[model samples]
Target: MLVSEVPFHYKRPDTIVYRCIETPRNRWKTKPTVADTILVVEVVSPTTVTADTIDKRSEYARYGIQHYWIVRMANDDGPAVSIEMLTLNSEGRYVSNGFRNRTDDYAAATDTLTPFPVLLTWEQLDEGID
Candidate 1:
């Protein structure tokens, strides 16, 4: 299951991928530890670039989150954004899987690297925004 802005210890990531039973509790009362999370995604903004790319990257790796994805929204009118995939190594550090950017070739932007492969277009990302 996927949840957004869920608490993981003291940090609340933009998105989280976790395993949940069909009949999960009406609400999860406690924070999920690293063991409960499969992946965490952080959407980068101008003010949070350092925190997302460096600080949170280290913190999430230290916590042993299986996967960490850093998303950078593009300012131009080409494609929506780019994603950097990081996987934890045996040494308890994150190694780059690769960076995926949506180019003119829409088919090439497919998310085959992540556990969840749903494609998100710029329109879907901009929904409900001011």
Candidate 2:
């Protein structure tokens, strides 16, 4: 499935999450469950700072999302992508895998990895809507 800003959940109906689904299935007719998601990426915003860092972190773990990625754009001092990767542990909680921040080469860092190759760069993500 190739969609943007779509809702996903089973038990929690009131809360809706929109992720950059790396590989959504073609037959999906409803919201994606954790099983349906191989990888999840969230672009952090001012309004969602807490939600992305705290609330959603725990929620996705509870929902059994295997891999979670948070992308934060750099401010005035630099133009870069800050990526935080989390892997779900056996205890159903997330443990930090590390980050690809301003000084790191975004593409080289995430291009080759397990579950899914992110294959993303700060420039592509920062491109203005045409």
Candidate 2 lDDT over 18-119, as tens digits, reads 455566456654555555565667667777788878887887787677777877755522343687888899999988876777575545435546455557
Top-TM-score structure, candidate number? 1
Question: Residue 15 of model 2: what lDDT?
Answer: 26
Off by over 4 Å in 2: 1-31, 75-80, 105-109, 128-130
Q: Write the per-residue lDDT of candidate 1 for residues 1-130, one digit (tens) a residue.
A: 2233355235579898866544444465444545678889898888888999999898888777879988777653233477788889999998887676665455443355466675665456656354
Instruction: Give residue 35's error in model 1 in angstroms.
Output: 1.3
The estimated TM-scores of all candidates read 0.70, 0.64
For model 1, what is the alpha-carbon lDDT of residue 44?
A: 86
Alpha carbon lDDT of each predicted model = 0.71, 0.63
Per-residue error at 61 for model 1, in Å? 0.4
Q: What is the C-alpha RMSD of each candidate to the true structure, in Å?
A: 5.1, 6.9
